[model samples]
Target: FSEVSWIPNKHYSGIYGLMKLTLTKALPSDLSKVIVLDTDITFATDIAELWGIFRKFTDKQVIGLVENQSDWYLGNLWKNHKPWPALGRGFNTGVILLYLERLRRIGWEQMWRLTAERELMSMLSTSLADQDIFNAFIKQNPVLVHQLPCFWNVQLSDHTRSEQCYTEVSDLKVIHWNSPKKLRVKNKHVEFFRNLYLTFLEYDGNLLRRELFGCPSQASPDSVQLQTALEELDEDDQCYDFRRERLTVHRVHLYFLQYEYTPTEDDTDITLVAQLSMDRLQMLEAICKHWEGPISLALYMSDAEAQQFLRYAQASEVLKNRKNVGYHIVYKEGQFYPVNLVRNVALKNANTPYVFLTDVDFLPMYGLYDYLRKSVVQLDMAHAKKALVVPAFETLRYRLSFPKSKAELLSMLDMGSLYTFRYHVWPKGHAPTNYAKWRTATTPYKVEWEPDFEPYVVVRRDCPEYDQRFVGFGWNKVSHIMELDAQEYDLMVLPNAFMIHMPHAPSFDISKFRSSSSYRNCLNTLKDEFHQDLSRKYGSAALKYLTAQRNM
Candidate 1:
């Protein structure tokens, strides 16, 4: 085949052999018939059935094939040849039964010489390469071609075409998916073909599940047992309390440390701070297992809820034996959760030189601690004012079981899905609202625009704390972000580092709170009073510092 000389077309260069039908000329003179099949086809019947078609061809016919089911050829050739059916809309080359002796006797090489002419070659190059040339040759000599039954090459491009030909799956002899959109589960012939394809391989449930849903092939016994238990649990029971049984039944822990960085004796100073409320025992356990450093957890709830958590913690041997974990209770009266106040209390208890402020639900990915440790060591702690920010993603709402590893958790995040900003500028304010633009970056960059503080922030011990006055959900942390900007500090967003936020039901109704009078009053105070106070404290220093940072 390689000895045959052929003209190369840029569009069809990859399949040059198919474009020129090079194999036909390379065959010996004794060979009379040849059947060519495309790779994107499936054979339902015996190969002998396809070979039987060549016997029906007439003495003058050189090729026997089915017409293309689509109007794609007509559209491509319409510029040169007008009207719909003038040149007889082409045939599909996918299933071709050719009489090699008849083609050689007809002087097929003359067609290649005509295609090489400068004027004709330019025209053929612009059109669909091989198919167009074959159609033109057949049009010039109509007696040299014969049309086969549509059933011989069943086109599954359009589902409607199936009704015109084969009505049942067993009737199909050859299935050709020759359309731009290939065979998907949504396609009409998918069910018919999928069942037949699966039958050829002796269907295995475990292999199919792993291929479809990314289930681990070599999952440990503990993972399999936990998955089965979770499926058997009642849907109404939101809180499952069987930590001791899980520990005894499964030899391995729920989560494992994949990697840990060893720090110098003098550089071992960092604390993770989080604020928790009722019905968050599962999240607390995950955080304890995931982090390798010390943690300062502030539990903000009623006296009864605090006691409930304590009982659960004592029952679980893993949490009870951890000496590095410390708990602080901030007993509150009302149903409203004070976001900033509890966070402030947790930050205050952090005794390390650097502290990471985050929520209990956020689970840091593996290697996050090592990345942060390296970042902090390179920074000038005394003179450089900076805060490290990490990207956060929420899991799908319907997913019940937590992933056992960081790679598993990341595979769950839908591609091209970005987290929506929790807080937007309310009632006509001049602030940028599109937070997704930050994700276009691939490396750490400074946040000079209106940045939100909803993500986890790692800062020095002397950095300004959250304001305690702003109560529940709305604009609590955002106000602190504004203050940090006004104090001339750099907010660097790390695009590579990530933390997955576990799915859960909302603690309170967001729409009801947004419409209440108290919420409107809080918005007013934040814009008018807070802005004025910051301006009075540092009038021009903020702008000057911002200019210097941009220059750097």
Candidate 2:
């Protein structure tokens, strides 16, 4: 009887038979040579012919194996060994003729020790675990291996066909159904192999039919109930299920804030400021349509980009309906985006007591304005010094129309897709860090101010404005946040409010800008200027604050 205990290989669970190969050391001393074959194969020729191949091996050779026909090993297995020519003849361990005496004499146990090492396994990229380690060892000692003919292992996989095999069907010595077990449903080659295997098993037509389609008696009551439940799931029930599973409720500090007073009608004074580019016209239009109330929009853009935007805005129906939108053109001759300067210009133009600083691509969700108004009234009544900070969300594009309610928006979005400013919040004494934990639900609840995130910030007009010296991408809005934090101002994040950021490419090309010496010089100059100004105002304390704020 050809019997062996099917113990799972520690590294390769799928190829469980590999565990038996490691125990070759326990075999009888007289048994010097043994033919190792995978279970998913059938012999076409006599077993004596395979044993005769041991005569062909050289003195240095300990094993004889056929090369893998698939290109998977060529890319994944041989990635690090790109320049080596030996990689072309990558060996397969499925059908190997092992010389037990030579292996024992050469101390083959060291290879098994390396396989047992967890650190070594973690470093390797190959999915076929044991085979990958074997190939790596063989490559290092190339003279210890002999390549057999492909006919000895006629692989039946997606890439391997009968026509591609080295030998004719009548002359073939072995049929290795390597992938037929998994690929029999979709692949014709695997299907053909499956039929041949069934025929060899002496399965009749009725038995074959029963094997292909499961027998009726095997069906369970649980499966029938599950089918009935699936049949009853309507579109509304599906939408409810999707929302329950996929929607992430971002809980912030404001959700627990006590609201004792109602906002007066006169307290709704907020000017929205955004630095715009030509490509963000759709975003501007969306903001104008969704944001309720007669709030002012102060938009800043480059001279050329502003002219292009004016033409677009005149034609857009969304922009035409809005009566309170204002555009300011800041003249700059070069392609460099003067983001901080543009924002400062917008800040200067704002007439209201409170300003909502945000990008053109962001818009407040429904009922946020009412919530903000109430919060502002409560804050004013309590005499609390704070800036309103709202978390930002990216929209999922499944729905055609803008979301009218939070419930509808939650249904459309995947909870896993929720992302916000990561480096904004910091621990009690630590410097600002972009820790991954800060962005998730595990974020610690503290009443302290969050620094360096300003995508959507509602601040008092009297607060420290944006530093005008900073240019392009890096540390543009961050300087303002740092200054506020250093001054002991509270940056309160509103839990109930979230602004949806419309999908668009970043305004500045970071890769192109980072390479430019002028961009680097501009950033360094701004940093020096900030250091000088803060040093003059706060003395040695400024350096300590700046160091922590800059993550130094």
Candidate 3:
């Protein structure tokens, strides 16, 4: 983008704006033409009609644009107003049709550069960077531009003075809010256009769909009324059944926040990769404060929750200002947590070479970020098949102040204020961390893998992704750990680094797993199938290892 020579001013100086000049080279060779548009515009007609206008372009015309409707370029509205020179009226880059093939043939790159260089000597700077350079180029070569009608781009800026374009509100084909004030623009017919925008905002998208067609196996009988629908189906075919709902789901918005963090060669920091729903959003401030490193979060939410989250994040003092956090939303059509799916989303988005895959509920010990970085280098785990485990603990007391160092945590452990995570209820989960050994060791110590061991670890980003087949509760995390063992990655405990899980209300899946026998049966079936699949993938040795661990 910096390759384009353009003068920058306060209002319009983003390097991204200069990217428009390089479209011919940026895009593929086969793409002959493209219509670029600004984000702050509303289409009043089908965009296909706008694409049709390209058919009328002459052989010499390489760019199609609508002329500027405002006096910003006219240099008459304000005192000492000086805009970059435009022939009669400057064109808007907001709505552009670039003839890439034609632009390439004319050596468009050199032409734009030369045009900008010639203009900058007379006009020191430009308020509209790309738009100014474009107008200056067209001034020199008038035959290369195809002028679009004013109706095509109905500008609604402050004192646009476009009365010559249209008489009624119905004349607008595309409404470009080309002003800082946006909807509050000083125009005659602002209300009608504002109402049209509001109408689309309040519109219900689901009302447009006639019927669901993707789930081919599921029957959609019109004969079954809404009332007593569940009673009519078999016990195994309930809508709330995990298997049934899971199959009907279609994943959407997989990478909602794309390229939030680009990997750099020198980036050796550990990124905290986690998943959470809207309920745990407040936990972010604490987690980020303690870690002070990059975080990639996968947010599982509905469409409505997504909108609410954006508003919440904006209002949040800590979240809105932070540049280290990347929030990616993954929308699925079911009530299940889809835990592994969410974990994979976070894992894949982490730009750093090392990632500490943990739950959102856990808060790291202070300076764990720097400790992990130092440990990775000291242990030489950057290129080795090793997983550096961070010992996890939990407390029964709800209002305990977080310990800042290893000494304070050990003191609390001696006082029985904190215990190993899920120590009594589910010992197998973090027991493999060997808290007894972790307390005495001052350096990274090797811990043998055990079945169902899922301690939070800082591993390389290329570690096998969580097996997405397991959803809800039960075998989700265990399946991932089992695969790591089969692949022969050693799990070593980091003595200084630790994470403490904050107490929270039990999730719906956990409650179901305890009370509902049917849910347990379904989970057991899934677990057995997962074991068989793992055995087939890693051979009989993997099954023998699991059996040996279970016997112990």
Question: Each candidate's lDDT (Cα)?
Answer: 0.61, 0.59, 0.80
User: Local error of candidate 2 at 243, Å?
Assistant: 51
Candidate 3 has which clashing residue pairs, if any?
none
**Model 3, clash count?**
0
Name the Cα RMSD for model 1. 23.7
Candidate 2: lDDT of 491?
A: 62
TM value for model 1:
0.45
- Relative to the true structure, candidate 3 reaches a TM of 0.81
Task: Predict model 1's lDDT versus the native.
Answer: 0.61
**What is the lDDT, from 0 to 100, of the residue 109 in candidate 2?**
67
Candidate 2: worst-modelled 10 consecutive residues by lDDT: 250-259
**Model 2 CA deviation exceeding 4 Å by range:** 1-265, 294-307, 381-383, 395-414, 421-455, 521-525, 549-551
In model 1, residue pairs whose N, Cα or C atoms come closer than 3 Å (at least 3 residues apart or on different chains), thus clashing, are none
Instruction: Tell me how candidate 3 scores on lDDT.
Output: 0.80
Please give, for residues 1-552, the per-residue lDDT of candidate 3 as tens digits: 557544454454366666688888889989999999887888888788889989999989989999898777788988998888787878988899999988999999899888888877878766776888899899899999999988888888876887777675566798888777888987887887788876764454343333555434554453234324545445654324655443433344654532355564555788999999888877888887888888989998766677678778778877767777888887645667888878888899888989999999999998988888888888887668988899999988878888988899999999999989998899998988999988889888888877778888888999999977677778888888788888888898998988999888888778877898877777767777777887899997688655854575
